[model samples]
Target chain A: MKDRISALVFIALGIFFLIGALRMPRTTEYGKYGAPGIVPAFFSIMVVLLCFIMLVRKQRSNSESSSTPAEVKRAENRRLLLASAMFLAYVFLLGKINFIVLTSVFLSVTSMVFLRKRFILTVTISVAVTVGIYYLFSRVFLLPLP
Target chain B: MYTVKVFFESIASTLSNPVLLFHLSWSTLLGILVGILPGLTATLGVAILTTLTFGFPPEIAIPMLLCVYIGAIYGGSRTAIVLNIPGTPANAATTVDGFPLARSGMAGFALNVATIMSGIGSIVGAIFIVSLAPALGALALKFGSWEFAILAIFGTIIAGSLTAPKDPLKGWIAGFLGLMIAMIGLDEIVSFPRYTFGNIQLYGGISLLPVLVGVYGVPEILTSLKRVTKAEVVLDFSKSERKLSYLETIKKNALNLLRSGIIGVFIGVIPGVGEDVAAWVAYDAAKRMSKEPEKFGKGSIEGLTAAETANNACVGGAIIPVLTLAVPGSAPAAVLLAAMWIHGIKAGPLLPIQHPEMIGYVAGSFVIATILMVVFGLLVTRLFLKILLVPTEILMPIIFVLCVVGTYVLNGRLFDVWVMLLFGLLGYFMRINDFPAAPFVLGFILGPMADTNIRRALMLKNGDISPFFTRPISLVLIIAITLVVLSKYLPKKRGEKR
Candidate 1:
C-alpha cells in the first residue's frame, strides 16, 4: 500500500509540473536564445515520462525484493517511523528553544537514542561536547547563531 | 593605457594585502584540521568558516575561504588513508586503496605521497582558475536566457543520472522531486508565486542551509543509527602492516601523481561537478592503466595516491567556473557563492572587467593553502588517526545539532526551524527507501537557474522552442543528455555468438 502511494505521489507531481508549463506566459524575445518555455516544457515532459518509466519498472521487478519476512518488514517500518519522528520533533523545537539550547538538547537526546547508550553518560557527554563546539562556532568565528 | 595600469594595480593590491595573508594561512590550518578529523568534512569546514568570514573584509574573506577549500580537500586524504573511513564523501574513493595500503603497513608513506600529489594537482588546477576563468568569463557575456535554461536542465539530468548508475531513472526521479520542492517557494524571476500558498516566509523560496543539512547530513545519521556491536574503530587484525618510506613511495609513483593531477584539474574545470566525481574517475583511470590491476584493492599506494590527488586538484578546477561564470563547480561551491555575495564582488558575466586580477590572487592563495595542508597534515597525523576511535553515537548527534543551529541562525526565524525539521524528517524517511540525496541537491541548486534562464530564453524566442536546438552549446548538451538517458537502458547485445 505504501509503495503504491509513493508511486501515486510521483505521478501527481508530474501532473503538477505539466500544468505549470501550460499556465506559463508566452515568450516575448526570439532573436538568438529561442523560446522561453523550451527548457521548462522539456523538463516537465521529463518528469512525467520518468515517473511512468519508474512505475513500469517497479511492476516488472521481481516481487521477492518487497516480499521479505513479514516480521522484518514490520520492524523496518517501525524504525523508519521512529527516525522520522525524531527528526520532525527536532526541527519543530529549534525556534522555540533558541539555537544553542536546541542544538545542545538535540545532540544529547539523539546520542542516547541512536547509540542505545545509558541516559546519564549520553546526556553528560552530549552536553559537554555540544556546548564546547557551540562555543567554538560562536566565540571563535563570531558568526551569529540563533 | 588604462588597462595596463589597472592590471599592474591589481597585482600591487594583492601584494599589499599582508593581513589577508595571515588570515589565509591560519584559516587554512583550521580547514586542514577540520578535514582531517573524521566527524568533520570539507563542506562543514566551509559552512562553519562562511559565517565567521561574514564580518571580515572582502579581500580577507575570499582568500581565507578559498584557502580553507584547498586545505580541506588536501587534508581529507589523511583520515581516508590511515583509517578505513573517509573524512569526507569526496575522500570515500581513497579508502578503496588507502586503508588497504595502511593494512599492509604503508600508512605513513601513503599519506605523504597523497599530500604531495594533491598539492601538485591543486597547482595545476589553479592555473586554469587564473587564466581560463577570464577567457570563460568574457565568453559568458554572450550567454543569454536560453543557454542558462538548457544548462540547468542538463545539469540536473546529467548529474542526477550519472550519480545513480545502479538506477539512473531513480536519480532523475530524485531530481524532479528536488525541483518540485524548489518550486514550493515563491517564484523569484516572474514574481508570480506558484506554491507559496500565501505564507510570507514561503514567498522568498526555500533557504539553502536547511535543505543542505537535512538532505546530506540527517540521512547520514539515520543510515548509521544502528549501534556497532564491537567497540569503535574496527580492529584490523592483520599481521603485515608495513609502513612504507615517504621518499621511496614518491619516487615509485611520480607518473601516477602527474596523471591523477591532470585528471583532477579537468574534472574541476567543469561547472557543477566536483571532487567526488574527480576522485572516483581518476582512481578508475589509474587502476585501468596500472600494470597490476589486482593491487588496486589490496592497499595499493597508487590507488590511494590517485584518489586523494584528483579530489584535491578539484579545488582549483572548481574555481574556474566560479570565478569565470559565477556558476559554482560543486555542492560546497554553492555556499561559497553566498560568501561572495556578502563580499559584494559580483562573480558573473562582468567579473573579468570589474576585478581582472582577482583570479590571480585566488591562484596564489590555493598554492599557499596546499602547502599548509601538507605541513598541518603531517603534524596532526597522529591526532587525525585517533578520531576514528570516537563513537558514532556521540558524533552523529553533534552533527545533527549543528545542522539545526545552522538553519535557525540563517534568519533567527521560527519558520526556518520548521523547514529544517520538515525536510529532516522527510530526508530520514527517504534514506530508508534507498533514495539518493545528491539529485535533490542538484535540483535545488540548479532549479532556479533552469527556471529563470528557460523563461528568459523563451521570452527571447517568442515562445518558439526550436531555437533550443539551433544554439551550438545547447545542441551539444541536449544530445549529451539524450545519449546519457538512452545509454542507461541499452541492453548488452543479446548473446553475441563470438
Candidate 2:
C-alpha cells in the first residue's frame, strides 16, 4: 500500500513536470537541441516511465502483509504525526518569534512528547540546548540565526 | 615523485599552522561523537558541519570536513562492537563479528583491532588518492561535453541501481526526480524561468544545503523518535583487557588488511556506493578467504579487521572521484563536494590545473585525520561509552534544532527552512518506502552538469546526437550504464526461470 501510494505520488510529480517542461520554450538561440526545457523533459519522461514500472512491480508482488502489530503501528503513527506537527509549527513560527524563546518552546514541547515523564528535565534540557545553540552560532561562529 | 613531494609539503604546511591543527582535533572529536550516535550518519555529520563552517576559509573548512568524514566512519565501529547496533550504516558489517567478540569478553581487543585496521585502511586509501587522483584528473581533461553528459547519467543510474539493489527502479525514479527538481529555477542558458511559479525566492532555485539537511537530517530525527529499542554497553572498556594481544592478531592478518583496503578503495571509487557496501563486501571476501571460515561471526578478529579497514579505506576511495570528476564516491562525499562548491572551489577535470595543491592537501588531511582518529579512538573509549548511554529522546531534539539552524544559516532565508521541512518529510517517506536518497542527491549535484553538457554537446555538433554514442569515452559510459541496469534485472529473470 505504501509502495503504491509512493508510486502514484511520483507518477503525478513526473506528469506535472513533463507538462511544465513541454510548455517551456523548446528552442534557443543555440539551436533546437539547445532548448532549455529538453533536459527537464527527458528527466520527467524517465521518471514517469520508471514509476510506472515500479507501480506494476508493486502490484505484482502483492506482498503488503505487514508483520508489525496494530498497536505498535498505531503508537508509531501517533509519534510520527505528533513530531511532524511540532516540526511544521516550529518552521512556520520561526522568524516571527524570538529565536531563543521559539526554539526553547519548540524543543521543550518535542522533548516532552518523546521523553514522556521528567517534565523538569525535558524543559531544562530544552532551554539549555536553545541557549547553547544561540551562543554557539551568534557568539562563537558569528553566524546569524533566523 | 611530484605527488609524493606535494603530499609531504601539504602535510608540512598544515602541521606548521597551529590554528589548523586545533581545528582538526575538535572537528575530528566531534565527528566521532556524531558517528557514535545510532541515527546520525556521516552524511548528516558532514552536511551540518558544512553549513556551520560556511564562513570559514576553504583551507580551514575543507580539512575540518575531511576529519569529520574519516572520524565518523571509524567511530561507528565503537557502537557496533559494544552495543551490537551499528552507530552508522557504514559499520553494519562490523556488528557481526564485533558484538560476538564483545559477548566473548574480547570487546577491548576487537575495538583496538578495529582502530588499528581503520588507520591502516585510511592510510592506504590516502596513498591511492595521492597517486591516483592526479592521473585520473589528467585523463578527465580529455573528456568533452559528450563524455560528461553520459558520465552524469551513468553516475546517477549506477548509484540508484547499487544503492537500492532490492528495487533499482525506485532508485532510478528517485534519481530522476532529483534531476527534475534541479530544473526548478530559471534556465541557466536563457533567463526563462522553469518552475519558479513567479516567486522571487524560487528564482534562485532550491539551495543544496537546505535540501541536504532536510533529506538526511529531518528523517533521522523522526525515525529515531519512532524506534523504542534501547541499547546498553555490554562491558566497560577500562575493565576489559587492554593489552597488545590484538596487535599480534593484526600482524598475522596483514594480508587480509591489504586486500580489504584495496576492496574498500575500489568500492569508494564507484560513484554513490559508500562505506557501508565496502565493509560488507570486504567482510564477505575475508570470510571466503579465511583459514577458519567458521570463526567469522563467532568472534573472528580477521572479520572485524576486514569490515573496519574497508569502510575507512572507502573514505579515501570515495574522495577520488570527487577530486577528479566532481562526482562523489559516497553520500558524505556528496556533501563534501557541495561544501567545496560553497567555498568557491571548483572540482573536476580542471581541478588539477585550477587548484593543483588541492589533491595533495586532501591526501595530507586524510593522513592527519587518520592519525587523530586512531589516537582519539584509543584515548576516548570510555567517553564514547558514556555518550552511547544518552537517551535518544533528549539528543534528537537538539540535533533537529541544529539542523534547522544549519539550514537557516546557509542563506538566512525562511524559505530555505520551508524547503528543508518539505524535503525532510519527503526523505522520511522515501526511507519508509525503501527508496534510497543517495542517488537523488547525486543526481541533483550532477543535474546542471548533465543539463548544460548534453545541450552543449548537441550544439557543438550542430544538433547531431550521434556523438553521444559514437565517442569513445561516451560509448564506454553508455555501455556501463546499460550493463548496470541489466545486471539488476537479468539475474532476477534467471531466478524466475529457475
Candidate 3:
C-alpha cells in the first residue's frame, strides 16, 4: 500500500515538474551564457525519468542487508488525537498571547501533559525558560524577535 | 607582517562591535532552543534569520549566522538525549546512543557530555579555519571551472555515500536524483536555457529555501505526526545530579575532538554537503574506533560527543570554500553566500582581490561565535531538558501554528502559507515511505552549484563535454559519482541471484 502510494505521488510530481519546465519562459542571455531553457528542460526530464525508476525500483525488501525496515504499531488513537490537539493549541496561542507568553504557557502545559508533572513545577520551569529565552534574545541579543 | 595586520584588525573590529557581541550570545541561546524543539530546525532558523540580517554589516551578519549554526547543532542533542527525537536531522545519530543513555536515567550526564564535546568541536574547527585556510586560499589560485566541477561532484558523491545508515546504494540513488535535478536550471557558462519552465521565479531557479524545506522539513512533519508522542521521555531533572566537568571531559576525549574536527573541516570545504553529514561520518568513525562499539547508541557518552562535536566543527569547515571560491560548503552557507551577494561582496574566485579582508573577518567571527556557544551551551543544557517533559498533545499544535505563521512571515504572502501546508503534507507522506529527506535537501542545495559549474565547464570547451573526462579533478569526481551509483545497483544484483 505504502509503496504504491509513493510511486503514484512521484509520477504525479514528475508530470507537474515536466509541464512546469516546458512552460518556463524562453530566456536568452547575451555573450554566450546560452539559453536558460536548457537547464530547466534537463531537470524536468531527469525528474520524469527518476520517477519512472523509483516506481520500477519498488521491489520487496533487499534481504541481503543485516537490518530490514520495520514499521512500529502506533499507540492508542486518543493519545494521538490529544497530542495533535495540544500541539494545535500551542501554535494558535503563541501568536495571540505573545510569543513569550505563548511559549511559556506551552512549555508548562506540554511538560505536565507529556511528563505528567505536578502543576507548580510545570508552571515554574516553563515560565522560567521562556522568560530566560526572551531575555537572552530580546534584551541580551537585542534582537527584534517576533 | 601583512597577515598579522589582517588578523589583528579583524579581531579588533569584532571585539569592539556591540551588536556582534549581543547577537553572538543571543543566537547561541536561540540556537539551543530551536535545536531542542523537535520540529524547529537549525537550517530553518538560519534561513529565516537570513531575512532579518539582510541589512546588517557583513561582519556582524556572518557572525550572527555562525552563532545559530553552532548553537543549533549542539542544541539538537538536548532532545536527542531527553526525548530521543533528535531535534535536528544531524543529531539523529546521536539519538542512536543518546536516548538509550537517557532511558538509563542518565539524561543530565548525556547532555553534559554533549556540551563538552560541542565546545571541543567548535574550538578545533575554528582553529582549522584560522591556521589552514590561508594556505588553502592560495590553492584557489590553481582552480578553474574544471576544478569546481570536480569538487562539486566529489561533494555530491561523498555526501550520499556517508549519510545512508544501512544502504550505500540508496544514498547514491538519491544523490544522482539530486544531481539530475540540480542540472535543471539554465546552464551557467553558455546561458543556454536548460529547464526553466515558463515562470520567471524559476529563472532565478528553484530557490534552495523551498526545495530544502520540502525535502527535509515537510517529510519530517509527516513521518513524525504519527509517532509524535510514542516512546517519549521527559527528563526529571531533580532526580539527576550534575554528572561531569566540561574541561575534564574535553581532556579525555581530545582525540575525538580532533578527529571530528578534521572530519568537519573536510566536509565543510566541500562545495555542497553540510554539517549533518560531517556529524554522522564522525560519529560512525568514533563508534567503529571505540574500544566498545557496543557502548554506542546506548547513551554512550562518546557517541553523543562525536556527533555533536563534528557537526559544530562543520561551521568552520563550511566557511573555507565559501571564503576562497564563493561556493558554500553547506545549505546555510549557501544562504550566507546570498547574504554576502546582497551586501555587494562577491565571494567566488576573484575574492583574492575583490574582498581581501573577508577571510579574516569570517575566520574571526566564527571563533568568537564558538566561544560564545560553549559558554552558553554549558549553562543551558540542564534547563532545556525539562522541556522534554511537555505532553505531545500540547506541543504539536503549537509547533503547527508556528510553522504556519513563520511561513506566512517569509513573504507575507498566503502563497507561502499554502506552500508550507502543501510541503508539510508532502513531508509527512515522504516520512511514511522511508525516503530520507536530508539527501533531498543536500541535492537541492547542491543542484545550482553543479548546474552552473558543469555548464561553465561545457561552455569553456564549447559543449565538447569530453574535457570533463580529461580534467583530473573532474575525472576523479566522475569516478566518485560513478562509484556512488554503482554501490546502489549491487543490491539489485544480489536480489537477482536470490
- Candidate 1 lands at a TM-score of 0.86
Give lDDT tens digits, candidate 2, residues B312-342.
9999999999999999999899999999999
What ranking emerges by TM-score with the best candidate at the front?
2, 1, 3
* Colliding pairs, model 2: none
Order of candidate numbers by DockQ, starting with the best = 2, 1, 3
* DockQ (Cα-based) for each candidate: 0.37, 0.76, 0.18
- The CAPRI classification for model 1 reads as acceptable
How big is the positional error of residue B151 in model 3, measured in Å on the Cα after superposition? 4.6
Q: Which candidate achieves the best TM-score against the true structure?
A: 2
Q: Which run of 10 residues does model 1 chain A get worst, by summed lDDT?
A: A28-37
Ten residues in sequence with the least summed lDDT for candidate 2 chain B: B235-244
Evaluated with lDDT, which candidate comes out highest? Answer: 2
What proportion of true contacts does candidate 1 retain?
Answer: 0.43
Q: For candidate 3, what is the interface RMSD?
A: 5.8
Query: In terms of DockQ, which candidate is strongest?
Result: 2
Off by over 4 Å in 3: A1-8, A15-33, A62-146, B1-9, B100-106, B141-143, B146-154, B165-206, B222-225, B237-248, B400-412, B488-498
Give the alpha carbon lDDT tens digit for every residue of B1-498 in model 1. Answer: 333344345445655667765777788877776666655666666766776667777767877787777777777777777666677778889889877766666666667777777777777676556657667777788777767777666766776665666667767877777766666554555455555557888888888766766666666666555423323242343445455576777778788878887788777766556788889999999999998899888877788878887898787877777776676677667667767876888787777778765676666666666666667666765565565566777776666666666666556676776676677666665655545666677677778777777766655556687888988877887898899887877652233333
